[model samples]
Each structure stands twice: as C-alpha cells, then as structure tokens.
Target: MNHGDTSRERGRRGATAHVDTFARDHLPPPDQWPGLDLDIPTPPGQPGPPGLRHPDRLNCADELLSGPPADRPVFLTPAGPAWTYGELRARVDRIAHLLTGDLGVVPGNRVLLRGPTTPWLAACWLAVLKAGAIAVTVLAQQRPHELATLCDIARVRHALCDVRAVDDLVRAEVPGLRITTYGGDAPDDLLNRPAPEGPYPAVDTAADDVALIAFTSGTTGRPKGCMHFHRDVLAIADTFSRHVLRPRPDDVFAGSPPLGFTFGLGGLVIFPLRAGASALLLEQATPRQLLPAIAEHRVSVLFTAPTAYRTMLDALDGHDVTSLRRCVSAGENLPAATWHAWHERTGLRVINGIGATELLHIFISAADEDIRPGTTGVPVPGWHARVQDEHGDPVPDGEPGLLAVRGPVGCRYLADPRQRVYVRDGWNITGDTYVREPDGYFRYVARADDMIISAGYNIAGPEVEDALLRHPDVVEAAVVGRADRARGQVVVAYAVLKEGAARDAEALRVFMKTELAPYKCPREIVFLDALPRTATGKLQRFRLRGPAYPGGDQQ
Candidate 1:
C-alpha cells in the first residue's frame, strides 16, 4: 500500500469515494427525496454572516470539532478518564491517519462502528467522518443476524468496534466485514496502536457526501437506513439544538439514548459539540442510573423518552434533580399525566418534540415558556408543517390528519421503495396523525395506521391509554387493535399495574367507559408486569397485535 496522497485525492474527486459505494448505490432516486424547499432560518437579530455554501463543500467533522477550547472536557464516560477537547482532537486525528494510511480507508468507505456510548466510540465516529468515510453505527444490544442484515445493507468491509461488546458480531460471519477491536488484549487492537507523528487534516469532500447511514426500525420491524449528508449533520444542530434547545458553553448534557440512534447522536453528540458544551454519555442511561448521575454530574439538559421521564418521576425524590434545567421527551407520545407529574415533582418543564430518523432530530418542539405538556409545539424555525387528510388536502384546525412537513432537513431513504410511502408530493409524511389547534400546537393523535376501526367508530389508542393512566392503579399502558369476528377489529389493551393493584379487567374497562366514548372503550384488558418497549422506550404496539401478555391473553 502506498503512503502517497495524490492517488487518494484523485479517488476523493471521483463520483464515489473509495471502492465502497453501497451507501450511494442504495440512495433513493433523486426525484423521490423529500422536498427541501424551506430556506434555512437565520438567527433572530443576529449580525450578517457567511452565506450558506453548497452542501458538497461542508465537512461536519470540522463544524463540530474544530473550534472548542482544546483543554476543555467535552465528554465524561464511566469506563475511563474523560476526554478534553485537545486530547479528543489528538485521538481523532491519529485515528483518521491510521484509517487512511494503514487501514486503506478512503472517502465514502462504509465503516461499521459498534460499542456502548464511550469516549472511544465517540472518537471513532468523528474519526470516520474526518477520514472522509461514512459511519455505520449500530446498537450494542443487536444480535448477530441483525448485524448481518446491516452489514449486507451497507456492504461494509471494515469495522472499528469495542472488543468487549462485539462477540456476537464476530461470530455472525457477515459476508464482507473485516473486524478491528479496541479495549482488548490482542496485539492488533486498534485503540492500543500508536498514533502517527505530526498533524492530520480532515478530508475535504463535497458537503453532500454521505457522512452517516443510520438505520431505524420502522412499523414493519425491518431496519430502514437513512442517508444523511455532511451538511445535514450541522443542519440538525443549527435548526433544533441551536434554535430550540439553546445550549450554552457551560451547560452539561446527558441522555438515555445510545449514540447509534439519531436522537442520541444529535442530543448527546452533535448538539453539545456545536455549542462548545459538554455531554455525558452512558452505556445504560435508564432512569435507575440517570437520576443519581444527574445529581452527581450536575447534568442540566436531558434527552430521553416519555417512558423514562415517567420512570424517573418515581425515583427523583431522593436524587437532587435540582440541577436539571431542561428535559426533552420524544420517541413516544408524552402522556399529559407523565408531563404534569414530572413538573409537579421537579419544577422543571419537560419539552415535548417529534422527530424522525429520516428527518434527523427534533423538528417540532417547544422549550421553557413555549411548552404545552401534551402538544408537540410549533415547527422549529426553518421548517413548514401542516395537517392533511389521506387525500393530501389540508385539514382544518382541531381536526386529526396526517402530519406532513417540508424543511431544511428531511427524509432520504437508502434505496427502499418505502421512500414513496414516506415522501409524497414533495412533503415528508411522518407516519403520524396529529391535530393542530388554532394556536398552532400539534397534538399527538395515534399513528396514521394506529387508529382502530371497531364497528363504525374510529378510535385512537392513545386517547384510551391516556384515560386509563388517570386511574392510579395503572402504571403503564398500550392499546392495539385485535382482530375480532364480530367487529372488524376491537380495541384491546395491555397494562402494567401499580404494585398490589387490583387485576380485575372488568373494573378497569368500566373506568375507561366513564372517561371515553362507549365505542372507544377498551373491549378487553390484560395485565402484565411491564409493557413491551423498544430500547428507546417506544411502545411496540405490533408485538401486542394478537397476544396481550406473551401467549394469547391474560384477562
């Protein structure tokens, strides 16, 4: 292998970087992309600045890692010493050198990154982008077959992984993946390798160059990868984090999401870095661990799901959460009860937002004075949103319809025919049903497909779930439509009971009947220890399509 630069430079200038074109090969047809017609919003009353450059000229790594104080700590990890920006920069540069020089990585090469949210994992993500390669990040909990599927989708040949977590991946025998480990005893461990002497400049590539290919679990349970350009990375930080969340240099951010999730990447990595703020990462950021850590680290900004906020509400009494200034809720609907309960206890407002992997991070959200507990606030600056019926015509205020938005950032699926399903007539149809009030706040209705048609009435499961949660005995709930011979489908509910609460399904059904329309009442109720949820704490309604509790039903 030659250590020369001109050959690699020629490769970078080519239509596709390196020999790995899986990301490009899989991009949906250009005409199928969501219409990015909304102009990027300028900061209110700010001085004139640099004009928006063509996306092909932007390098997100430079945007996030370039200007912070070198000695300031950017992240804190439980596994090892925290990283200062200076130390983090050194590591990123060295890794970029190793990848391009010795490991034969070139621009656009798809590099698989697997591990918990640690400093090394964070550094590896940045390094891949700095090397002009696209990063394919996956969760640590994923089993081999899932990893195999991602590997096939990405056509990945190289992996920079944590030895502690990738045993399943090593055994999977993915067709093209070549593995390299960190934090291992092996002599070839990538983390232990020495950095090349001197400086390393990040790759200069088109702003539209694919930087990350993030895979998300859609309604079908199949992983759908969203391709984001280098410019999309900074665009998310600018529109959502800079404009809405409003972080400062001194603020400390924390989250429950794995960095593999776009929410986590934006909340726990990109946003903080963009603001010159500090971020706290954990392998396990569940409520059980987060409460104490918040007090211990003085975490001011929190990013997590509504279920986590509900869980943290139970554990916050002893832990001093006085340090938290802002808590963001997404991934699932924020039950009004959960939002009110957290505020009553913590005196801190939980910001409600709706975001998708296709569009990057939180786009519809409100913070501080703008927060309305149950409503996902107005479109963040730089976006346009409206509610439309199934026929794609605008619906009046206070009526439920599909939520569609066109903005600076929007969906671009990786060669999936479902691209047509998500983007229609130049708008991204977020698979959600929402009611926009006259005040312009968007209320969460069921998913566009989650509505249950029983007999003649169309009922939203969230409405019934909300009513049931009002009963002190119900701690958690999920309602799904179950096929029935008498009715096309009936509303069936799965609920988790507060300890020692009555398990009588009849009484619970009676309570729901009083609060909701008779047709919307749950036809059957089943009790369980806990409701099934994704790692991000989203209720997996599909898992409850037929069975209530594991096998059949638990009436």
Candidate 2:
C-alpha cells in the first residue's frame, strides 16, 4: 500500500493521490464495529444525542479552529506564554502545509505522534487532523516492542517524534517507517524550523473518516487501538464539555494526564478549545509540583485521577488553590472520602466523570448542580447509562450490576474482535460495575474484573479501598482479590503511609472493621511504600493481586 505521497509530487497542484489506501485497508471489517447508539437519550425522556451525524465532509481542525472566539487565547505554557486561537490556527495551518509539502502526508494517511504533552505535540496532532491524516498518538513511555506493535497495527509509516527518547524509536524495528524528529539537527527538525508560508486547506474529509487511533492502556494485555471518527471527536466536546463541564473562555484548564490519554486530550485540549478557553500544560506534574503549578498558573479547571487529588490534598499546605473553580476526576473510582476532604478544604465540588478511550471522552458526568458527592453522577447530556445483570438485562435501581451505556459515541476498536465483548445488543458495556439510584445518580462499584467474590459474598474492591483511605494513616490504598483455598478469594489491601509514619497493619484492620461490614473488610493489610499505578496515575490493582499481607490473616 502507498502510505503517503512523495514530497515533490504532493507539492504540485493536483498531483497528490489524495488518499492513503494503507489506512483504509486496516479499518476493522464493518460488521465488527459496534452499532452506533446515536438515538439514545440521556437517562431517558431527555433529547437524544444531537448532531449524531455530520453532512458529507467536515475536517475537525477546520471546524474547531474556525469556530467563534477565534481571536481569543487557547493555549498556555507554564512559563506564562500563551497562544490565541488565531495564532494557534495559523501555526496549525503552517504545520499542515509543512506536513503535506515537506513530509508528504496526505488525506487518510496515518501519522505516529510521540512525546510528552507540549504545545508542539498538540499542534502536530491538530495539524495531522487538519491535513486529513489519522493521528496515532502513543505514550512517550512506550517501550520498543509496544511502539512497534502499535505502529504495525495501525499501519503507521511515518512519525513526528521527540528524538530525545531515542531508545524505543531506534529499536522499534518497524520496517519502512520514516521518522522525523522534533529536535533534530538545526535545519531539519520540524519543531525548530519555521512553518512554510501559505494558506493550506484543511482536508475535506467525510464525517465518518477515522481521525484518530488512541490505543487503550491495556492492563490485561497488549493495548488495542480505539479508532475514533472526525465526528465522534467533536461529539465529545459538544456533549461532555458543553453540557457537563460548561467551560467558559475565561477558564484556564489544567491537568496531569498526558494528551496521549483520551482523558487528557479532552480535558486539557478539546474541552478548552471548544469552550474558547486556554489550557495550562504541565510536562511533569507530581503532587509536590502540581499544587505550586496550579497556584502559579491560576488554573481554573483541574482534571486528574482520584489518587492525584488525594495527594494534592496532602500537599495543599502553603498552596493557594483558590483560582480553581472545577476539579474533574476519572480513570478510576472517586472515593467519597477524598471528595469530601477536597470539598471541605476548597469549598468547590469536584465534577466526577466516567469515560473510556473507546467512547472518545466522558459519557457519564455531572458538574455543579446535579452532582451527588458519592456517586459518579448521571450520564452527560446525549448519553444513556443503565446498570445491567450478567444476562445483559437491565437491573433494578440500587442493585450493583455491570455498566452499559450508549450514545452518539461508542466502542469502535481497530481490527480487534474484543469489540463484541464491549458492545452488545447496541450497548457499549464498559467493564465497570455500578448501581443507579432512583434519583438518576450512578455510583461506581468497581471494574467488573476487579470484584472480589469471597465465599459467595460479592465485594467491590473500590469500596474496601475507600474504607482504607478514610483512616488518617493511610496515604494510598489498593484492594485486590487474593487466591485462597478456603473462601475461593479474599480481599487484600496494599497501602502506602505518610512520611515517617510507622507501619501498623493491625490498627488499620481494626479501623476498617468499624467502618465496613464484616465481609467487606479487607482480610489482609499489607504496608508498602507505594501502590503500583499506571503512568496515567490509575491504580494497577492487577499487579497487587495475590500479594501476601503482613497482618489480619486470622486463618
């Protein structure tokens, strides 16, 4: 397959092939894709998901950049630098021109994106979309084999990479992939060179054209690419950002999730741009660093996981976070204890959301008024979320069941048969356990795979983790099912303590007994310096499974 056009040939008027058959060739067979549930309404009786389909052709870059508030600032760096929509649009245009003229990128081609979250990376993503190529943005931390797997899976033949991390790129061993570095030798680097001068037209792409291939963080095994269309890309911004986040032009978005994660892409980029707001990008934001950065940048909207928020709570002393108006949590269950503490200290309600890479962004989320502190909130406008039993039938309210949702966006995996497991009977069954209230709020229980069935008493790991976190001594906690000959499985908890705090597993066990039901209390409490987590800050409970605990084993 011809991956992209030749530079000289592409430069000539009407000389380009205009289509990359390689990308088109790899799309999952039509029958394998989940039937889009665009007609579903939000929690019933509300209007159905709107703008479910766009007419003929529309490039996301053109629509988002040329929309209203084009002259307002849209991007900000930690060093106080900012880019208005007009400037960012110009840069995207120039980059798009360079992509086609110098790099030979054309419509339907696949462009591999790598690097930390930076303005240049963001621009490259938009530029790829603007040039009509599918952007396959992988995590910078991906090793050689992982990178190679994704490249081959997506048929990626070109890359815009950060050369500083050369180990993986050099070792990926993907044949025929021409790599272009961002910080290459003076004149050849894309980031260092000036964008070619010209008004490059954004590709006139079909609304259903695949725009991005965001690979999921596969905790179970190798990551699978979740293909998203140009229309689905904008659908998230319109539904979640518009209906739930309600970000304004004055809001300054901040977050720790890398743009490689769809969570960050929406929170830090798409949401802000769609609302005509600016975003503050932090390359290395830890608990110690994030608080000061938030105070320094005067960030208004913060998006991160529950773990980071808890850590930030620990490090909030001497930090002024009054500039923050909204805090969005996802990637894992948001414990009510953490939410209560943050609200107690900041007087601002944290907007919790449940989203996945497959859906593009958030589906269930609530902001200010509709928020129920302990729950994951209701479905974002344009979505329908329902709890279901093992049989895929809807379960009554208050019964913990698998979470099944459908909306304008749904799972559309790239060449992966796991699509059937995720989407059934027109519903995207996100592998999460939840219980809905009569009031329409959805409470997160645990990942369906993360549940611990000890002697037939079904237990949610997040519930036990939440109980563990309430104890003042526990800084971080993860609960998992450990194999047991007697009870089939037992709940084991791994915890991290505060600085200078001594390990007291027995005291934590006793404390947990008081807060939780007898069966729900963790059978084992293990003290570790830290719980394992993904680079995106999600707790890797799978890694903690079967760990021997130091105390509370009353066998």
Candidate 3:
C-alpha cells in the first residue's frame, strides 16, 4: 500500500479490491474514453516566480510579522480583543517555548490539532509550525471514529485541542498519545512565561519533506490522507496570490472555511501570512456574522463557497459589503446564475477555482483580469493541465475527458492502493471531467465517477442537478445514475424542497423537462428530509448510491 508498490502487486494483494472490481466491471474500456486536444491559447505574459524553494527561508510567524506596524492588528476575535503583529509574535514565541521545553515537541513530530476556529486555535497552528513540528489539523466537526482513524493513520504522538473536543479524541484510544488543552483566549500571563533563550532555528526541510497531512474522502468508503510539505504551502501562496488574488500587503483577509480544511487554512492563514497581510479570525463565520464583520473590519478580501455567497446575497439588504474587493468560491461549482447575480448586485466578480485535497490548494483558478464566467479558468502559474482519455492519452479540444495535472505539487495517497488510479505517469488524475475551450479556459463537466449513462446517451449528474436547483422549489439536489435494464442506467434526482414547498412529483418533473433536455431530465424524483454530507460539507454521493436507494431507480 506504500508508494513503492506497482499496480500489479496492488491487484494481486487485493489491496483495493472494491475499487479494482468496480473499475473492471463498471467503467468503460480505456479505448472508449474520449480523446480531446486542449491547446487553449495562453494569455501573453512571463510566468510568475516559483513558490518558496527553501523552506527555512519562510516562517509563518516571523515572515508575516516582520517589519509590520507596531500598532497594527494581526488577528481579531469577537470574544477577545485584537492583537497586533508584535503582540501575536510575542505570544507565539512564548507558546513555542512552552511546547518545545515543557511539552517536548520537536522537529518532525506530528501534532494533532483538534479545535473549533478561535484565536487560540489560530495561535496553536502557528506555534506548532514555529516549534518545527508537523501540524495535522483535523476538522472539529468530525465524529470520534473518524478522528481516531486519522490519529492512528498519522501516528500522532502529541495533540493540542479545545477542552470540549478532548473526550472524543481520548475515546478514539490512540496509543501513546499525549493531549494538551488550550483555553479559548490567550491569558496575559502566557507572555510572561520564559521564551526559552536565543533564536529558534528553523528545521531543515526539503520541498518534499512532509509538513502537513490533510485527509480527503476516497471514492470508496475510507478516507485517504494527502501529504504536503512546507514548500507546498508557500507554493500555493506564490501561485494563487500573484496570479489569482493579486493582493496588496495591506489587504485584510477573512473567510468562513474551517482552519482544518485546507481552503480556510490557505485563505485565512498561509496566503495572507506569506504575503504579510493581516487576517481577521471569526469564531463564527455564519452569513449573519460574516456580513457585519466585513463592514466592521473593512475586510478587503473574502473567501467562501457558492452556498455562502448566495446566503450572503439574500441577507445583504441592510449590510454594506462594498469594502470587499475580492471574493473566491470553491468546494462546489459556481453556477452561471450565481455568478451573474452576485456581480449584478455587488459589482465584483466571484473568482472560481477547482482545487482538491490531494493538490494541497488551488491549481486551476481564474485571475481577476481574465475571468470567464462558468469556467474554472486557466491553470495557475507553475502548473500544467490537460484532458486525457481513459487510456491516459491526451484528448482533442472541446471534448470531455479526465483532467490531468502536473505542477509544483502532486498527490500521494496514504497507504492506499488506489494511488495508482489517481497518479499516472506523474500527472495527478483529478476525477473531474472537463472540456478545454479554444480560449484555454476549462469548463467543468461532472465527476467521471458520477456520470450518468441514460438511454444510450451520457449525462453528467451535476448538469441535471444544476438545472434542478434553478427551480424555485428545490433548495438542494443530488443527481445519480440509477440502474435500469432497459437503458442501462437512468438519471434520478434526490431533492430537498424549500421550507413549506409542495412535494408534487409530477409538477417538479414537468418543471425539469422545460429546463433541461428530455434525455437529461430525471426519470425519478425522491423528496428527502436531508442529504448526508461529510464534515467538510461535500455531498456523500456514495451514501446515496447505496442499497437503500438500490440503483436510484426506486422512487
């Protein structure tokens, strides 16, 4: 299951037996996968500089606070007062000393961090790196079993967590693990603690040395830990900051993503810290709270998902969001209507990007100067993207194919044989299906794994889901291919209606027909109380495809 094993050995050992079996029996032959040529025109310009090459040269605590205004704010929270760069650095230094001297955390040790997003949580993230230990930030919303699995997989020895979440971590029964609890706010006495003497030396880590491990859900039932290095963190900042965000050092960054999710970690911490910009930490980033915080803080840059944007737009009647200069959306596709509505209302275009846990952060994103609505835009600087056929061959232009990427960072799955299916000939095969336009922008299709073949024609699940969502009655929708003997598979829609909405199936079916092509319409509709989702807010499609649904054909 390690990186060194070959595909044949993996198959023989039954390492990924379910995945192998599904691919063998269900997927089209390699030759049948579309071949598309993607020679999209590149915008004229020299590429930006490479991301951090030397890990020692970049320290989040020092690099972010160096040469800052002595009185300027570094972090702010509702429960605690704002701290300046000088104050944050001083607190981080003391915490670093406590971790190194008292807790005995040293370079290369893995420290599991489990807590809600708070000022103390932010400081602990920085202090863990400052102490030269690898920080593994687990989602605070995760169930105990999932947390335990992650602790065991990462071989976490020491942990920093909020007191509320400690019992769950302890219940997981990770062997030989020591846990330390941190209060929600930094105490005044912490700064008086000893600073452990002279300059703290940076760990000598290469671009490939594992610095963080973020787990992502596998196509199968298990989750796979995606390993990243110190350089990858800086690489994301360098690429997205220079080419996509283009933020000034004075810009204020804020977001709703959990600190544990790489999206929030990159947007709220790494990107701003790497660029010497300040981040406002929100203990609660709900739409109600986010709008007021933006106005109160004069935040310039915002990061969130499409759902959040829609919610914010609905709640913006009395709030002043004009100070926000940029808004970035991920975690799901940005519908054209959502994009248009936001722009018509705010005069700011919502930048859309497609990033996966394996790639660390964004690799495909649209810059402000070159945004094409409804497209994922061009590859970020220092990366290359192409559409490949099932045989792993390059595809023709404007044809849907598997998106393959080669860049500063690639994926390495944790002890999973499915790594071979994802990484082929050094290119990371993002399971997304995409078409490259003549203009070089990538238009996202459905996930290859989620495509629906209905009545001898291929249908993308997201396409139908998007159409269904346009209906006023549908609040959320999930489309899956249901097995049918007559047509091989049929499109089925699972929908959650808006509050107090009628659940008349015939009326909804008629509405869908007018919105989408006849072949693309859902053959069956099932009203659901709620759709299951992971802690990170991604839909658990596999759960919908289970025996309870039984091929999706059942109403």
Indicate which candidate wins on lDDT: 1
Per-residue CA lDDT of model 2 for 1-555, tens digit only, reads 121222321132122223985644555555444545444344454444556556657678777787756578788887756888878888888888888888888787889988888787898899999898999988888889989999888888889887776568879989999888885686878866766786778888877677889998866677888988787888898788877777888999988899889999999888887777889887786777889888988999999888888888877889999999989998988899999999998898999999998898889988887888789998887787899998889999999999998776767777777887887766789999999999899999999999999999999898998988898878888888877889998888889988988788788888998999999988877888777666677776766663343433334
Q: How close to the true structure is residue 94 of candidate 1, measured as C-alpha lDDT? A: 83
Give the candidate order by descending TM-score.
1, 2, 3
Q: Is 1 or 2 the stronger prediction by lDDT? A: 1
> RMSD in angstroms, all models?
5.6, 6.3, 7.7
TM-score of 1: 0.93
Better of 1 and 2 by TM-score: 1
Off by over 4 Å in 2: 1-18, 22-24, 37-52, 68-71, 192-195, 546-555
Query: Looking at candidate 2, what is the lDDT of residue 339?
Result: 91
User: Residue by residue across 124-229, what tens digits does model 1's lDDT show?
Assistant: 9999998889999988888898889988877788999899887998977997677889879887788777669766787776776789999885445788888888
- TM-score each candidate: 0.93, 0.92, 0.86
Model 1 misplaced stretches (Cα beyond 4 Å): 1-19, 42-55, 547-555
Candidate 2 local accuracy as lDDT? 0.81
TM-score, candidate number 2? 0.92
